[model samples]
Target chain A: MKLDSAGLQILSRHECVALLGSVPIGRIVFTDRALPAVQPVNFVLDAERLVIRTAVGSKLAAAAQDAIVAFEADEFDPGTRTGWSVTVVGSARAVREPEEIEYLAGLPLHAWAPGSRDHYIVVGTEHVTGRRLSSVDVG
Target chain B: MKLDSAGLQILSRHECVALLGSVPIGRIVFTDRALPAVQPVNFVLDAERLVIRTAVGSKLAAAAQDAIVAFEADEFDPGTRTGWSVTVVGSARAVREPEEIEYLAGLPLHAWAPGSRDHYIVVGTEHVTGRRLSSVDVG
Candidate 1:
């Protein structure tokens, strides 16, 4: 697979959606203590938004309250040197409605760590974008 | 730049250190309202600990007041089909001492975004780990 700078710059909406739909994990970016941070999380696509779960008294809960956040997911094929990444920027909020929480909880999401998984953070996207890199582009 | 599973595992550690040392950006993972949430942040490596700046109303400050947190960083290179990721898991705390805050402020770190930088969230890492992926492993 080959990619050009122009192609990388102009990602179609369909491509963005595809990337988001195909990948289940991504890095979420937000501000904590006035510093930039990113973390890997398994998310579900809910009504074109990203949803995740965590525990109370977690760092993520503290930093993302009504704040601007960025979520990203990508897949790269090492053999062919091809990969695409999609990022969604939006504000995050804690879901309050019982119905919404129950619906989100039914998703096939699991935390790799052990703790009381009792909190939820939803990133409501304002913008969606993506970029791709490939060996063909270099050639 | 080819790698086997074992090589990928070894590179994960190097990737972790590199991710932590290369920049002031990291991600905070925690639970938000019973769901998992992640946000990006700027951090400094202080005495092997990850330090960040936050404010009173900030999420990090609230989370770190008394809870376990996860901080992470990584760099992915699609060209060589190789990349590394690092994560630090530990407890976070607020730096109240004037001397410590002043010393941290002197570090060569800058916000990747624009905003009024305040407060500080420091994650004292009790564990650090990383991982890599390659075609061979996937195949």
Candidate 2:
């Protein structure tokens, strides 16, 4: 990994996906009513794609079907003011196949929101970008 | 202060603004080359608006001026599988006035990313919605 003068390291696609898998929660951003809306969801990855479980009637499920979306996850230390943030922008496709839904249900992913979370939204890993802040603001 | 049967509480605008003030880090989601992009920034609240200090040449500074954007912040507890998230969708107005810029620079807000952070992006609180999970997952 090459670190910039400011100690911000740019992460590759592989590294970004690996970090995504370790985190269970991330924010999914989509256009709702022509405005950007963000919601946090617990996700499990099928390779580099993000699989989110949500209620069929929820706004997230409604907006994610075959629409362009962005998923973001970050970890920061408030004490040190340093952390890594990864963002993935892709198409949110709805999983309609019964077999795939069953397979995803078997995964450890659980919806934190209280509701009948039966809808699955998949976002492909097409555009990925990430940056990690160093211990200090390096110049 | 409305609490649902599922233990999901609707936070009041005042409560939401208070929670935003308590956190120092959040994500700013904006359009980058017609695609949604998210970046983590340390923010300070100016009343109900989000103030982010960023580099002049950064994508955030470039895309934020007079643009529709979303700012999100949340806190979650993994052990309990519960958390609260607040998202704000509004227009980002660049702080261009020399006096206003100087005033904002004096505020405690500091840029975590390394660079000459000489720009300020402010997002108003016109659209604010937040949901908090109760102690138990009430169904």
Candidate 3:
């Protein structure tokens, strides 16, 4: 296991993507009124791209268009103090093509929030990084 | 159960603070190299302030100094389809004063990562907002 300067294990890109696929929810960080804002979102990983469905007039939809955003997903066990976190920094853009929307609509991406979530914001996996904390092996 | 325009329940300021105390982990969004980045860290809520401990030369400590960042903490039950998320947008300043650092070091804020985490970053509760999604009560 490779460890970073902080003593946390470094995860490869493949491991990060796989861990992302196993999670159902994540937090998307975007600029709101020129300040950083984070909102919990349910997203689907499609071929290294993050597909998020939201309302057309929502704040996220407006801020994420042709913007750089950060998406993070992780699972932690506080009891044993073990977990892994994966972060992706990339450009986000809304899907405007008809055929693309139709294809995304069938990708099993369901919105947990109430209301019509027709806007599909896709975040590219341009930069990916992950870290893990594991219990020290004891004989 | 007051619902917002998006049909999600709006959590009061008091509720948001209390929920933040219930959890020991959260995601902090800050700028890294002029782009947004999200890192999960263990934090403690001191009254209305959020305290985080990190390494002195780590990226978080460097970027969080006197910067406006976003902190989010939430808990969700996937089986019940219910969750609540609270976000705090405020300025994060490193505790440079020796007296303040000593006081903060006495708090229960502990780092989960294995490292010499001596730098303490305190985020004030400038703008706090929260939303919740609950299952409809049939009874």
The interface root-mean-square deviations, each candidate in sequence, come to 11.9, 2.9, 4.8
Off by over 4 Å in 1: A1-9, A135-139, B1-15, B18-84, B87-139
The per-prediction CA RMSD against the true structure, in angstroms, equals 11.9, 2.1, 2.7
In candidate 2, how many Å is residue A98 off? 1.0
Binned by DockQ into CAPRI classes (incorrect, acceptable, medium, high), candidate 1 is: incorrect
- Model 3 residue B116 lDDT? 87
Assess candidate 2 and give its lDDT: 0.84
Q: Rank candidates, TM-score, best first.
A: 3, 2, 1
* Cα lDDT of model 2 by residue, A1-139, tens digit: 7875445898887888888987889999988888878888888888678899888777788898898999999889887878888898999999999999999888888777776778899999888888888656622
CAPRI-style docking class of model 3 based on DockQ: medium
> Where does candidate 3 chain A have its weakest 10-residue lDDT segment?
A130-139
Evaluated on CA atoms against the true complex, candidate 2 attains a DockQ of: 0.55
lDDT of 1 by residue, B48-132 (tens): 7887765456555666664667777776543444455687777777777889878877875554333345566677766787765
Misplaced by over 4 Å in model 3 are A136-139, B136-139
lDDT of 2 by residue, B1-139 (tens): 6875434798988888988999999888888898878878889998677899887777788899899999999999878877888989999998999999999888888777776777889899988888897555422
lDDT of 3 by residue, A1-139 (tens): 9999989999999999999999878999999999999998889999899999888899999999999999999999888778999999999999999999999998877787887788999999879999998953211
Kindly list the per-residue Cα lDDT of model 3 for residues B1-139, writing each as its tens digit: 7987667899999999999999989999999999998999989989789999889999999999999999999998777668999999999999999999999999998788887888999999879999998853211
Worst 10 residues of 2 chain A by lDDT: A130-139
**Candidate 1 residue B85 C-alpha distance from true site, Å:** 4.0
**TM-score of model 2 (first chain only):** 0.91
**Which pairs of residues collide in candidate 2?**
none
Question: Which pairs clash (backbone N, Cα, C closer than 3 Å) in model 3?
Answer: none
